[model samples]
Target: MVKSKPVMHKAGHLFSFVLGVIFVIGGFLATYLKGLPLIEQGKASKNWPTTKGVVLKSKVASHRSSNSNSSTYSAEITYRYQVEGQNYKCGTVWFGSDVSTSNRSLAQDTVKKYPVDKQVVVYYDPQKPAAAVLEPGVFKTTYFYYVFGWLFMGPGILMTGIPLFRWLVRVGRGTDERGENVAGKF
Candidate 1:
């Protein structure tokens, strides 16, 4: 009887390896490109010089998602401050940009925190006086992107490592071109 040669399949393993590598790269990019900068800005803002500012207008802005029935809410707070005699108006509450929450009360609470005409401490960048924030330094939200990036990295590591481990095991098994076990053969 003639024996049919075994077919060795490495495509699946190669695919896994490629996918894993892509995930790892994506995770790193997310962390470094998006998360790290926000964190750094948050930390730096803590020491920025402060000035007196007044909330000109504070309101809740609603954003409806195009692809879904859901909506998000954020506090639209506009304030005015003076730096080196130049008057500037800014809407930034912090360095991470306006935070949107699904809960309306959250945005409402933010608006309440800075009601119209209320005076607040404004932290301004020395070099660029136009850049300023009401609440400086790192807050719980500051870690959002940083944590998200790491979340991707964890799965990426698993995806990458598993394929690599399997490839190593297969190589160690010493399979012939026909994928037959050749470990004990000459």
Candidate 2:
């Protein structure tokens, strides 16, 4: 009787799973660690300020859906200011709302709180005026990305690692079911 070799499907799965895990972990770490630094850099840059400004313009726009169940809103603002001995016009877009009613309400509230042509303080990067952000508390929009990234990453690592660990343990028992020795199972 001819014997078919045991394909290492699990091994491939493990590799892909581990890769996903690494991506999640790395993303979380990058977000967490870099958040503060980015904030600080915004503060230190000459171009950016945390002071009040008269909003030149404000409008609501839509962005690509983050998911099938949700939609997103973008609040664009144009503030006039001068940098490096030249007149400049800066505009920033704040994301608000999702498909959820609660998120939509939150976005509406933010809009109401900070209306068009209203005076407000915005945090912006000096190098890029287009890359500006509002102070965190003004809108109360939850840092969803940070939350989502960490949430998946923690479990992804475990989901990928545990199986690989179990496979290692099985291989360590010195049984070969695939013609290759146990030591070469991985």
lDDT per residue as tens, model 2, 1-186: 634434467566767787777876776774576443443443454345554456676655555555666566655556665445554566543322222332445445656666767866665556665455554322222344444556667777777777667678667876554435556546
TM-score of each: 0.73, 0.54
TM-score leader: 1
Question: Tens digits of per-residue lDDT for model 1 on 64-164?
Answer: 98998999998899999999899999998976557577889977988999999999999998988898899898877777777878888888899889766
Tell me how many clashing residue pairs each candidate has: 0, 1
lDDT of candidates 1 onward, in order:
0.84, 0.55
Pick out the ten consecutive residues of candidate 1 with the lowest summed lDDT.
2-11
Name the candidate that leads on lDDT: 1
Write down the TM-score for model 2. 0.54
